[model samples]
Target: MNDLELGVIGNCAVAALIDRDARVLWYCLPRFDGDPVFHALLGAPKDASDDGVFAIELEDHVHSWQSYVENTAVLQTELHGKQGSLRITDFAPRLFWRERLFYPQAIVRRLTPISGSPRIRIRLRPRFDYGASAPIRTYGSHHIRYVGPSATIRLTTNAPIDFIRDETFFNLRAPIDLILGPDETLQEGVVETAGRLEERTTDYWRNWTHRLAIPFEFQDAVIRAAVTLKLCTYEPTGAIVAALTTSIPEGPGTQRNWDYRFCWLRDSYFVVRALNRLSAVRKMENYFRWLMNVVASLHETDIQPVYGIGLESALVERTVPGLPGYRGMGPVRVGNQAYEHSQHDNCGNVILGVAQMFVDRRLLSPPGHEDFLRLEELGRKALQLYDKPDAGMWEYRTRASIHTTSSLMCWAAADRLARIAGHIGETQRAGEWRSHADRMKQVILERSWSHKRQSFVESFDGEFLDAGVLLMTEVGFIDPHDPRMAATVKQLEKVLGRGPHMMRYEAADDFGMPGTAFNTCSFWRIDALARMGRVEEAREYFEEMLKLRNRLGLMSEDVDPKTGEMWGNYPQTYSLVGIVNCAMRLTRSWESVT
Candidate 1:
């Protein structure tokens, strides 16, 4: 009965997912796309031979509860056994120190007794190179180092070394600290370092969330979603990952699983947009720098749909056969092949993502004339290929179409560049960009509209309906009040909506058909409905979508609409961004409270 019911804890450098029973099921070392140190999440079915787990087994545990410490990424899980009860606090140390962000690549766990004496067993098994090799364990007086083929990690703790080594049960009389991090000795005592980091990390998150201008309604859900999105961001390179894990299937045996641990420019656009709406501009600022580097590196090459977190352009896709996939499905992909595809919409997304930085006066390092000049290159590229064929946003491997999604985004690119040029006093440049946008708009309107289907089709002169085109009103490409906009929404829901959840499309692609509902498309539907003045209907659908989230108010990339079961990658950044965007759109204004 394994599911995506998991809690995430990270310091933006590293992240891990812990199940309801407090097992660290998924974790990557050093960085987000690095070797998975804990791979139990994609291990053998039923965890039959899971050698990548770090679990604390209570002797007679019967019940448990898990949640994030309010307004923070710190996770608190309590376990109740026949003998007694205990609480586990998990977080990666992150805080501000010496005027710099001091977020180490570490996972800190503190065990505290809650009731009568509870005994627990520590099972610390780590793997390397996608579970291909096991680590050799060597113990010191107060630490145990797990040495792998290429890397090593040490568990510096105050707990008894022999008890952890032999997987023996120990009494829960007081608090103990266990820090898993770089293979090095602690500068301070284990207790002092963990305690100091815990206090500071908790403070850091609370202060961060407190600054967010969240909607009055659904405040808790919005904060949680915002925190999840931030955790998915790699602070060093400022590249935001699509999700934390790889190879979680979109549907049972669909073999639709793909690695989501890298940055997709398209997804990054939505993530920063949502965060910007909440006034959480730090992410956008970091992303602007990352995008700057990405753009600078695109010398004589077309922009990729995705890139490695470290800004490495060639993300050669491959499978890791050593590890069985989620629920026994195979083909655990590592790098994303979308890096090789020509997704034309990405240029528009990049422009739209950074355009705000030009207008916002508050950004510390606003883009200057040079940055705008760099973006104009993307604008030119978008206009050149706006009507041409590519994979589209869905990343269809076998087919290429003049996708309306691609065209609309290119239109967005031209549109934003024109506006940016005007704001920057480049009137002549603005006029030229404006003409490019207007011409593309007319062509898109003429070619993408389907009189036969009574709606806007997915691609040029194509009748297949797609959820991607629902962005007409979202990116300011079209007014919501336009008659065609309403018809488009109606037709999309008719063909793609499964109950309240929306599928990416009804048309089949390389995978035959998409079985599960794409969560972000459903949120887009809510957005379209709200903008069309169907506020009540949008609120109804939004609530329905919220129910689909796990107990921790977290969601994945897709879900089983029929059974309300979550599928796909866990804690998807796209899905979390949806929660923020929809809540922001639907919630009542704070002035109403007064």
Candidate 2:
């Protein structure tokens, strides 16, 4: 199956969607950040067809359909047969202690018969380190071992599994059980099997969903988006990844692939805002603490745009030469190089996130935390380079430019610095930062806005419409109803809007290359319209964009308008945040109208 054709299956505890052909397309084994055990999706190796590392044949099945139990993450898939039906329910349960702490590892997939008893076949192929390492497997009663370089996977099945050369295959006519544990040694039949695993998974998700302060009319969509966002989070660290799978191409047959498994500083900012909107302020606060910890340990100059789940800074980009790119997009790469790029927007993002934490309704003060001091020092450093050209928010591959949106972010950083100083009674420093912020605003207004075009240009000299301009109102750089914003909105509509969806920009006109239409830009347009009191238009557009979510209510980085296929990385945290933020804003706007 193609990338877009893959299906998803999993309960809130643990769920994975097997394709129509029976390949585990996406899964986070042991923990969400653990290296992939089956990563054929990245790309097929040169020896894939011959060596059979990347190819797996599916059993002939009549039909298949998958769904989650209502308000729960427990996923159920029914496979039809000539005699009867085979059903599989998957979940990864949260083992809460007396303290109710969350554990990170454990994925359970249970297979049973739902209708007339039919024989079900199962296969276990374990590939470690993004399919680069092979493990030594030893099998015994209800237990199997696959040892690798850094980690070991112990597979246990309730039923007998036939051992092949390296893979395991078995047939079951009755209910069978399976357990996959990572990094831990396993004893035969050692785990206490919960008779009500499925029920517990259902209750876990239902209770979690009940906590959401959902006010939107489209309640289901909002809940699903929120769940997808939760699924992408690294619960232990409070770090949210950009997406689940890596190397999902942005364009067909292109090398615009990236590994999004790591947490991005920019994404955490949005996660905080989204969780706060759901009235789950504690989680957001935990993330703020995580951010504080990250910044506190690093020098002001050592701050990176992204970091590993453990806050590791050694993110050297390297390509897996043997593995082909996803869907023939060559050169599967891991470890982002953007970490090394001079993305000035990160400082602004950190400042904004910190300011939001203080301003949020559920505010908690981190006593004696050095992170805020470090962040303030970095903000000051960023101000020193306010006029120097640097990579903008988009992180374009070419030379840096004086991007207007990035400059606006710098203005936001200084503005927030001023606010933070005022909160701490540092009036002198606050005034200095306020003066710097005013200077940036003046420079942006003078150099970024184009009177001839009657809108804000993409950069200092480029004459084009950039959907990022919509952020001006959101970031408080300009009034939402300002005439300049209206003109910019008009320009965006004329240039970037394709029906109800919006592109990041006219890629051909500005970025010099065409790309898939960005999904988040659509949300920005909705926010802009709602802020401008275009309530009716904003509601209509918001509803229209909601139609683009996948059957599982997940969204990618971009979309293919003609085919309605989600492109880019799957389950993108930014897209989910956009959905939640826009929906919340739209709901509030509608309330104002009523």
Candidate 3:
């Protein structure tokens, strides 16, 4: 059965998820927010050879082993059979060519026999319009073109065209390379192009990872998390998408699924900040530019929480007609409605996301006085709406509340603006922003504190517990030694703990109670525990959370704490960010690395 146990392979331009048996399950064509070409991650309804997958099946298959090539996004999945074994090397070519980054909209797979003669069948199916239509296929001597409604994809392979077309088993006597890319013909032979690109792509990734100032311990986990977050970024615009897949449900048999393929301002804030910790500032500088465009285009308080990676705003949510959801769950969705949400925190997240650029000299293009004036526009909105009602960070659809998370982020925006102004010798402006920040912080502490429950609550006068309150400590709003900080942590554990994982909150929403623990919140709990002087306990929980990763050391959006099964969107950026943040917080200093 297909699960979230998949390895991701991609350059920044395009990404695909492959299962342990080397099935290309989920691949979006052309771009990250584009149509899904291979939709097997969300199963198709009509099963006449299953219309939305690409796979290589070995005869009498017995077992499979899969992993990423070390320090790289390239994936190698080896299938073992009674007769013999074979390996499939999959990657998207990314390297510097002709003095510019050359990452094409292509996926390359090389198949080689590792043992005695093995027989295999190639299943290359491509769908369009969210699995609503199958592409019309036409082939030449060495390539096949899949013509679709919006785009055309070409499959250029070195294997026998008749064998692939007839779906017949063939003896794996020699190596074959399959290049799935644009409709244009290749300029070189399949073997030559694939070989040069594969070697260069591997080198590019290893070189990138080598530069990261990783944590002394958990180096492997941190490297994988860093790589995964880098993959989430859209290089052309610097917008980081929340995840690769669209409508994987948060839990089983629940209508909690939402398309996470778009860029969320709140999520992008965390992603850029986490990468900045590893000394990878390109994403930050790039994302800062993206944020500037987003803020500049808007007139006033009309900003959105989410948007297309290409900076297109209006993401109208709708369900498609044909494809079944993941694991036979229905209602496959395409666009997201969160763009229409009054998240209220968008201004603050954007400000916080790019605040480092104002003060850090390491950036190539630092924000100037004009940029600070632009950021001040967002600060004004943050202060105006910090006490109003809106969707919280979790984006609850049915209800709007004066969320503490919203208020806290607004405070963070103001606080950071004060720091930035002070850094640039604007003392008067610094004092004015500092006054606004203090006022919001005092109000949040007073209104969000629930004396009845003796802990910080989700919203004003609310009694329900939420894991988001943990950010009070994370964002440096609350002193770690404060008694309420301890009380809030203790109360959260009492209410939201599910085995080793932690739920986002205890309150039921439009979908009733959530059934799974959010993966990011579990890591937040570990961060809170480590800060509360429970280092040993936090270490144990961190170990448990690391065990939650799928075989490729990857995480999704949520998990069934009862079953230890992943259940949300594949390769969530938020969940992966947690891995890097916690590793940085929990590891010993580099001074002691020797």
Summarize candidate 1's per-residue lDDT along 210-245 as a digit string, tens digits: 899999899988999999999999999899999999
lDDT of 2: 0.70
Better of 2 and 3 by TM-score: 3
Worst 10 residues of 2 by lDDT: 49-58
Q: Can you give the TM-score per candidate against the true fold? A: 0.98, 0.90, 0.98
User: Candidate 2 versus the native: TM-score?
Assistant: 0.90
> Which stretches in model 1 have alpha-carbon errors above 4 Å?
44-48, 590-594
Count clashing residue pairs in model 2.
11
RMSD after Cα superposition, model 3? 1.3
Give RMSD (Å) of candidate 2 vs. truth. Answer: 3.4
In Å, residue 176's CA in model 2 sits off its true spot by 1.7
**lDDT (CA) for every model shown?**
0.92, 0.70, 0.90
503-541 per-residue lDDT for model 2 (tens digits): 886645323554577888888898999999998999998
lDDT of 3 by residue, 41-135 (tens): 88875743387889999999999999999999999999999999899999998999999999899999999999988899999988888787788
> What is candidate 3's CA lDDT for residue 476?
86
Best by lDDT: 1
User: What C-alpha lDDT does candidate 1 achieve relative to the native structure?
Assistant: 0.92
Q: TM-score of model 3 relative to the true fold?
A: 0.98
